[model samples]
Target: MATSPGSDIAFASQKSMPSENLRTKKLPLSEEEVFYMNCRAVYLTVFKSSLENIISKDQLYLALQHAGRNPSQKTIDKYWTPQTAKLNFDDFCVILRKEKPTSKAELLKSFKQLDVNDDGYILHTDLYKFLTKRGEKMTPEEVNTIINLPNINADGKFDYIKFCKLYMTTSGQCLKTALERLQVDSKQRRQQFGSHMEELPARDPSSVLKPSPRILRNSDQETLSNRGDPRASLLSTARKFKASVTCTISMAANGNQNAKLTEPNLKDWPGVQSRGCFFLEDDGETVSHQYRLHMAQRSTVHLTIKPLNLSQVEGKLSPWSSVDTALYILKENEDQVDPQLVCFTDLQHREGFGWTGELTPGLYRLLPSTSGCRLRKERTPEPEEAQLVCRDDAGDLFLTQAFKAALSDVFDVIDLDGNGFLSLEEYNFFELRTSGEKCGEEAWLLCREHFDTKKNELTRQGFMDLHLMEANDREGDPCDLWVTLRAMGYNRALELKEACPFVIDLHAERCKPRLKAVRMEASRGQLEKATCQSVLLQGEARAMDGYENVLVHTRSWDFRITSVIENKSDNKVIIHINNELSKNCVNNRGLNVFAVEVAPQSSMVCQHVMPLNEHQEWVHHCVYSLISS
Candidate 1:
């Protein structure tokens, strides 16, 4: 009996705990069941953050999905009206399990709702965001199971009709093997792709900064605390010779009590620094004041704030040194605003932050706190302006010699009448053509107040000064200046690089000069600057037409200057005219020593110039040239 019992005991198998019919190795699962399980796993993963079995509306928002797409937040709000709405695990399962066979019209309407851009197709990014960031979120792995459908293009995008036919309308029973393959492919792709970690939201820079109390004198602070300033918040102290305010900017209430601002970096700007910028800030909890320096040389600057502390860095801004701030520099010329926000984070051991750039004489603005948000949220703060007025000292040469030389050439090119200054109209015309920006009248007035000018127009010196101010604000970087130079037809060598396409018809009412056959010649000029040639054409005075009669045939930009004459008067007349090359014109191969006399009604052709080299498009750098009589 003992021997038989030992042999039977060795071979006999015990029963499985849960079920006798199920495989011991794994549970028997259908394709739909596995997908539903994946969905449940995602729901659990997202719910883990709340550390609760129950889910709120937002939690549900992160879980709802249909055919790998999530309903919009607006749709969720339409149904889940209560803010404190909750759903248990069973309820969530019921919601996920419920689905109706949608008709073609209903599907089309749904697709139309998602296709807000009406692009006919949905972008991969849009789909991903919809499934993962909208009313209910889904895992990328699960979403990709559908994304790997045969219809998806190399770009991971496709028409909604394809999605409907493949994932929505198709029977789950038929998609078993394909779905299984898709799951495997998606997992392999994810493995090859790298990290699937969701990035945390961007940290607000202002979060690191201790909200500073307003900057004010002791008496002023006390007065402000008692009963706000009777005067406007934006006070003006725009005197030229005023003493600089204390460099130390009093700190606001910072998070770390240990960060003690022992000293200031100093107001070490290049020019005479005068700041009378004033403003105020009131957090919901407390009231304080903020101020920007007034860069007043003349007209007042309107300030605006973008509520957000924009972070230039993408992620992991850690162990930030003491709380820091930055300067936003702006140039206010009426409607012209070039806002620059600069931040020089202090070293770990440094006491405070300072922006130590030198400046030239002109109106400048410093705007801090760029908008951190794409849309305006109630929480983000607006941008504030500080008035910082800096003037050039007696001995300081603001513009470098080379820059001045180049700008002098630029001024001459803009002065169409060969006059010594640029009218606002002329400046705006050139600006619109070259930069696609129009200089507003307010900006013009601002320039007049700050820079040297004659006839209420921009003088050559003033032009140079404006550029100097721009260069200094950028810490002597010549990038912006170079753009203007090139646009104005100047080369790297500061030589005129192109012929001005515009003609300044100064005396057009009487006689107009025009370059005929605007199309460049077959043999283009080899260089950017137009080539010029001159030979004195001897002609006797005779009855002829005036300036309108001269036809300038521009061939290969070979000719730079031509005079047009037309006789508007009934009486025939002989006129004496001068043929001269502008001292400012580039690549001038002609001389100005000849005077030509023409018979009335007869055309007088000055020496026609041709390009020296015959294979490039040349723009005559003569922005303006004059033929005088």
Candidate 2:
């Protein structure tokens, strides 16, 4: 080597250097590996020596730029400062790794697999099935609504690109984790419930197993140390047990039974006639109607009588009471009416019954009848006096009276300024009085927004309209009224039950359709050749008024009516269709006679029209019976 170092000797000398020795120990290093190692060595030697094992802010900026990482101002602020500019080797590696670009191929592949049809588009149904197969018990409608969002497209269809973009963000990752946990829980639930588990077509399990790069890197192993397990919570366990017990009880009660069961008669039961102050002789001529039979401090009895002939009549007795004697007559007469007409009368007095100064509510079944009809009591808890006053069969008359009464009472109480209209403050007070809580900001704003500007306040008419709209909104579902009542401090189960019926009846009066049926007959012409027009009408009278002057289209001919004549005395209406000269008749001189019979104050529309006969021999026919619309 002294004479002229041979190649082998030179190589050996080079490999023996400190840096080379480190590389030689870790043989077969990749290019990247070697580069990083050399960079680390140089960094420690030059940067650490001068900077006390830390790189300065300027040094880090230069180093990051040299390494091809364009750190933003935010990143600089997060990791670099005059006093804490130096970063340890570990911290340096972590920042670089985080900054490293991630390949979207894995996420793309997962989304492609979820798109079952391979059509490049994922529909809500497709997503639903995929999630369900993976054990997510999510509603298809909800999934559909979410997937069809505005940003994705006007049509709400999702493609692979959009899917990846949505799920790759930090917020998206959080959502994905939550959905994954939900799916897992759903799968577990299916297994526990013995429900059928839907399986997806077999494929590479690894394809679905691949997670987003961010999720994988940041995935934390949830420890029981901080939050503990939800299943271990006493309240959660109790709730589950309670739900299970309720389900079991419901199933047992719904199972087949051998004999009809009836409530036992109380000992020394009072005779039906002597039980209450209200009495009706069994003349059997009285038609079925809603009637209040008795009023007591703690109990009230309501009777729904359907007088069928004299000796045989159908009746439903609803007795709300804490006393067993109050229900004795209901039990005794349970066999007198058809089982279908019997109503539930079993009402147990629970603790929260009169908490709101309202009636107690309960549901009792009139033991199974011979006909296998078991009627349960209605769940409306109106005051007996109110029920007596509010009659469903009274048509618009009852509504007008009730509305007037309610308006007068509410106006007297809410008009603090002695003005005809209510100011915002007064309206708020009224709301508080009615619901036991002030109206929310949004509700108050809505009320003010709809105020009559001319009056500059909520007038009686405006108030009525607002309340009517609110009532209409609640008429679709009776349960909504129950929830509202509960929110107004009527939270007891009995109280809700007692109040349900009254609230339902009150709202139903407005929404209820009054049209019974429409009947028509033409007097002249080959009525058989004439086109018959029949219109099955429904809805309120005011709504149908628009159609009153309109001509009704028929298959063969058009029917024009000037107006409908209502017979208030008999609760019937006469519909006169404007007739033309009988063109089909051999003698074209006679006018066609048309007549229709309808319920009084009914919103009637032409339902059906048929030609009588081609014979033209003075034929007369009328609609025999009226059918409920």
Candidate 3:
């Protein structure tokens, strides 16, 4: 009638009475004999060792098998005899996977969960509430010993959680010993069950293993309990168990295609730089399951980093401080995915800015960028531009796909006059402007003096150049767009996408501010042809690199450059350079080649660099004119 799915079904059946009666019979063995009996049970169950051997010869294999199975000490001694105390204390630890958490906060939380009553004390009722419903109540002495504390706390009440923790750590040895003792009790019960079976009719072997009270009818429980205790003598002869540390190795992928597990001797293993191991859907080759390795002590294992064929790691390495080089392996073939770089909880870790360490002896990962020395400020998340790149849920990079449709639209619209390539006039119309008219007042003001009201048509490369020149004027020739972008490191983006063809539609939308148009008679050889641009802008002036200078607006301002050209006498002279944002300060506009100080016979290239500040605005005009005196 147990409602809970896990409730004891054996206890419910009347036919199981024989097993119940057999289970209740106590064995005559002393506590010590009982303990070794438990050890024997574990050894036999896990490593197939017998009780006689476990009690006499402290075989290492039996101990290893015990540890590997992680059996409780009670289980360990379940089938052991009196003489099996030869196991060391360290050897007992092999049977345990986790040492309880050492952190105080975590321990306290565990205690509170067990202490169901808010009264702050763990009483018998609280203990019942904490343990399984079917668990038997502990005797008064057992409870006191389990929760023994000198001061119990200021309130003089034992904190069950704290007591359990203290007991688990301090009394773990004793508890293990006690569990081993229980093994003897279980054996006595089995014997009583066997005796009761002798009185019943022959049955199947499997049925004998099943619980039935009838099996205990003929068993003399009291006489068995009176038998001379063999546990005491066995405890005296058996060696006391000692605890020791060990390690485990878990491979992320079993049969790798390119990577191989060299001989177990890890001292000479070479680690390669690779993408390492990553989780994937269960495709037989790349298993994504997390493999675990828990070692007895952190220092017992030494991880060595051996450099393989790769130099430093190929990707940015600063962010992954917790990753070690052993977690990575270079790919064997170009067609294959890059060598895998993997990391684990203790197997891989970063100890310093550039240095990482691993504990697994094997060549687990490839060491990447040695130190933070190679990391540039722009490469990492700095205060100025944090979260620059978009990342997906799994931290995979998201690439911006080029707008092919946009490009097609641009080619369709800008290829005006059916020439298949945009002319300066055609480009102006697409930008919402007349071919040969000055921008309206609102647009002109937005543009600095870079826009010339006098000139009607802007030749190609005039759009963004004018905007750059004006923005520079306001900032006192402070770092302009090109210089700032270069310094900020847009070069990396350009390189990653350089191979993709430029989407004309995207260019129309994103590159609007940088384009320009101006009237220039091109050499006859340079006719109409659609081609890629290679304009390189380097100075504070001539901000527009290749496009026509199309000004959205205009404002009167001084434009500066690296150098200025001066004419000794009044004469028409023109100085031209590609990708230069130079303008004359006199009219607060583009330089007038005719009005410059040019002599009738001689001309001068004003080599003095123009000052970008406000105060120096009048110097260029004043210096040459005054010297005429």
Tens digits of per-residue lDDT for model 2, 383-500: 4322102225532212234444444434543454445677665555544334434455555445555544234467777665554444344332224333333322232332212111
Sorted on lDDT, highest at the top, how do the candidates line up?
1, 2, 3
lDDT for model 2, please: 0.30
Worst 10 residues of 2 by lDDT: 241-250
Name model 3 segments beyond 4 Å from true.
1-41, 44-48, 51-156, 161-206, 209-275, 278-353, 356-629
Ranking by TM-score: 1, 3, 2
Best by TM-score: 1
